[model samples]
Target: MVSENETIRRHEQDAFDSTHSQEERNEHGQFATPYDLARAMAEDLQSRVPSDSHVLEPSCGTGSFISALSALSDSFTITGVEKDSSLSETAQRLWANDSCNIVNADFFDYASSESEQFDAIISNPPYSRHHHLSQSEKRFYSQLAVSFSGVSLSGLAGLHAYFLLVGTGMLKTGGIGSWLIPSELFSVNYGEPIRKFLTQKVTLERIHFFDPENLQFDDALVTSCVTVIKREKPGDGARAVFTYGDFRSPRKTISIPLRELAALPKWQHLENYEERENHSGRVLGDYFKAKRGIATGGNSFFIKTRDEWHNEGIADEWLSPILPAPRSFHLSEVTSDASGWPQESDIALLNIPRTASYANLPTPVRKYLDGCPEKIRGSYILRHRSPWYSIGNTKSAPIVCTYMSRSDSTPFRFIRNKSDATITNAYLGLYPQTSMSEEELDSMCNMLNNIPSDVLINGGREYGGGLKKLEPRELMSLPLTSSPS
Candidate 1:
């Protein structure tokens, strides 16, 4: 029987997290669900699953779901599978008195067993990115996913995709399936299989997106969504509910037809389907060309603070003034002195010449290069460059748009760059492709600074923890309020 003492159980979870290293937890993509959220999800699952239903939890960590289900009803038989031996042992001990069974076995292996099926599958699967898995691991997961869903999983998919597909496959006909997976599945290219399976194979019931500003899990940085589906294949005119904000009381809800899902490049924005196209046709690219700042393979090694450079006796000629990260440089307008250094910040970029022989370079320059560690010098990005240390195209632009910021409050800041100092990849440099006057440039920056938050957020990708990022191409496609050209 599961422990009735909720406080004591929560204390055990805290102890378990303290015992595990951050690196170890990250590699395993192990993050426990908060009890409140688990309870809410369990309540929702209760509505879909039949009485006396058997529930399956894949990648169960510390038995959040088990505890939630036990509180709801004692009749529902629950099975939790965890790959980690220690977590499974703890869960077994915690729920020893309960009717639930905890298994310490690889889920992929267990899921492949043809003999078992469940009335409901519910879990927050691992969010491990594909890059962490070895070639053999990727091949195994991909093959199993394809076998289960008949849709070829992309090599780039995270571990969450496999759980969704395999777990759904293990469901009884007309069984219910639900998952708390990364919102990336709604936006990234690799989510095709899950999206296809939901629309074409299973009936997508509803997808609830948590307000990014208020995350459900404490430490996990992933923006999450709760997706509910049924095992039955879709028929004509099937619709799925998309809700945003708090699950208890959603801020917005929209029902979209299943057939229309395949046409969308991404599904997260369905929460704002009504106002998604309220902007004008004219975009930033119509007047100015946006480009990402240069990549100095190793920013720390290639960029130096003003004090560090001056103390090293490196001549001003060997270094070019560069803007620091947006967080470090606060001014909306950058002005340079006669020496072309931004008066606000002292960071500078080194322009190590590849054409010149290393031996023939100035003593200070040679000393600086000698100080660089082997790892920085041999980094993949640097190794690919003709002269590993030389970062090219260090020219400054008139306008620099803040590349990323918090989604809820911080709108993208378009800084008027009145200086000759270049920017790093942290900011997008906007150059007037066509002729424009000084007044036009000023107006452009002002307009961008005042642009509605939705205009920028809809144009860019929202990363974990409410961070919205705009790449060069994504920024160019956004509608600009004013014409500066």
Candidate 2:
């Protein structure tokens, strides 16, 4: 008879070949965790799991966690279940030295049937969104959440959340789990349920947020975090650790009392160390409407210098005094003319059309546009229908934020809007309405401008050439000075 290990290995290879064509893996965000990260997460869990514990690694991609567990402790019994047969097989081969119970099965399906509870559950679950799942599958996952957390999680919650919810359920009381997931859950609105579950149902022991500048996954661009939690809530006054910076080399560690964590509405704000001061009345949100910058489908095609506009025979009306990407706009305060145009500026602007418009431009411009490949045009600033120009008027806002920035030398930077030429979508335009007093708007602007660059970069997603993009929702989540209505 074939050995159990060899059987598992064969199944894993066969399943991998059958289930995932290379393209499918890429589409599904199925990049396996690097050994280093997996090892670190496993070690982090081992520090919490008691000796002789039963550990479960749900959604074990190729058994990185299993390998880490085996290396960390031979005494701890391990059970690894992988959705992909080929990966499960590979994991079986990798852990043949140890007698791990390896199963090739879908975690979402198998987890519900598990009769035994584990002392620790660990995984780097797939990040695929619910849309990828069938309606029946989504309902199954949603029902699973109800079974696990008592509270229902939206199907919109990413697969990772399901793993956490289901994995937590499979854990014995006092069981601990460590997960490698996108740091976005801490701040995103959709993650509110997960956070609530963590704080109330289980003990959220610690979260180690990685620096956004040094992306952890080669295949994925998102900044990630390792969340360690226990199945049971700790007693009163218990504190949970919140570590930030490089996980490999942490720079800061904070121990926040569970009560305090539970009190806070949003966990992302915790990273900023927000302190609530005694207040008498209203908040900034009460007085002024906070709005992020407009998003031009494409920036390079729209934002251009006057000289470039004139030289290219593009109308001045088609161009605007848009802020350069974060790196180019260095100054905080900008002086503008009586009409709000920049008094003196070094940057130049040029007109380019949206994807469809490119083919219809004049010969010279068309030739220039044609020289650029479709791949380049499809990116954020290039995909618009009329790429050569944008629509925002020159009525400048009192405050502006760099839509994209970096952390090379300067810590955080914001440029004041002083020109009549309004910025394109690459900026957060803060326009104060007539209802709000100038002082109140200025105060709010000052508060926004003061946000640290590191925080800004971390909150936003990065693009080509280290460029970062912040959606309106992401920017709105930043801790701003608020007064009651």
Candidate 3:
């Protein structure tokens, strides 16, 4: 009973999905674009280019963009470069028209050898995380940025950021380029190079950020934005349009000066309804220092519950009270026993002091450690330390906030740690600055806990799955609504 279009769509998805595992697709950051979005991008590109212009899709997947472009115009010769041979071949078969050309090649490699520039380069580049890349790959790309544009990119820059540079390199003089990229580039440290290139190198035309609550890709967790740039010199007083909501028809728009864009640390604020007036009032950073919670190289092996430690006959002296996972800790305040252990949480972190002699250790503790996995000893964090098991010195903070949250989930929990407890990377520890009192901190915690949802939305960056996360610096930069007296 399925319609022809429905049957065709189902077949296309089955063919694409059968070629690679989800892990492989994630490694390559390949998420198929929806037809509507691809069409929107094609229409935008078509509006700018001449009828006979040469257009390129650098990371075309299954030819969604190609089909859209073809539907828009038969005048332009559309060329697509896709890394996956199966998808490239599929695209060629589906769009068998002579106007379309699908090249099965790696975009980065192809871009390097390509001497001719295209009139328009439109793509949704791979969103692979930098951590997924090897050290050699990182070094090569880091150096590539410097050699290509004289801009030194952060080592943590993602695959999509590098694609922007490549797209820039492939752009003809005054040619247009548009990319559908994760919205994280607005504020993440790694996005600085791309932001610099956009402001200093290209004439940034418009940035359309889709609504965070209404995700574009059902399978992907990332919120996305469309970035439009032209390889033309920016003029004095030039400004870029910042649009929010749907990519095609935005709910709201703001015009930001190019100079302002260059100076601002976070572009998320541009989506705000109206800029807050300048104020010199003390911020969270003024009264407290925020640092991410401990990153134990191997959490499963290093972090254990009290039950597990007791079963192994480990002594309390060698362990530190650690907060339970953020989702498990519901209350805003944590009370402790006389031993300084969180009364409500049973989780404890395994700690080994550097000065302590393992030779003098209790037999039970030594035996337990001997049974530990060899992988833990070779872990990145442990391998670098003198003693493999030592977690280093971490003092309990007066307040802690979970670094990430789901939009519909409870607001980011700020816990008053009234115990000698440490937390994992899931939380950020907040220590009072010099001269700040515990009572003042208590008030600040309460105020921060009551932060308006709108404020949080504007301050934090949304990841895939509508998960909102804040870095220590971003959380600290947030302007306090009221001073804690």
Clashes of each: 2, 28, 3
Query: Model 1: how large is the Cα RMSD against the reference?
Result: 3.4
Error of 1 at 184 (Å): 3.2
Error of 3 at 342 (Å): 3.6
Among these predictions, the greatest lDDT belongs to: 1
Quick one: best TM-score, which candidate? 3
Evaluation by lDDT, superior candidate among 2 and 3: 3
Those runs of model 1 whose alpha carbons end farther than 4 Å from true positions after fitting are: 1-12, 93-99, 259-261, 269-271, 285-290, 298-301, 304-316, 335-347, 373-386, 431-443, 481-485
Cα lDDT tens digits, model 1, 102-145, are 88989998877746889998899988888888889888888888
lDDT of 2 by residue, 1-485 (tens): 33354345445645664666755765565767766777788777878878899888888767767767777778988888887766776776667455588888988778778789889988888888667778887788889888987767776777888888888888889999888888777766678788778777788889887766656766565677889988887788677788887675788887888787776655543555644434334333343344655465545554566676667655543345655665566677667767555775634344332343545666655554555556556765545535324343345676676655554333334555656545655566666545556465556666656655655665555432354556555555454434412
Query: In model 2, which regions exceed 4 Å deviation?
Result: 1-26, 36-40, 96-98, 129-137, 154-156, 211-216, 244-251, 265-288, 307-325, 338-340, 345-395, 408-412, 433-485
- Write down the TM-score of every candidate: 0.86, 0.73, 0.88
Candidate number with the higher TM-score (1 or 2): 1
Superior candidate under TM-score, 1 versus 3: 3
- Ranked candidates, highest TM-score first: 3, 1, 2
Error of 1 at 54 (Å): 2.6
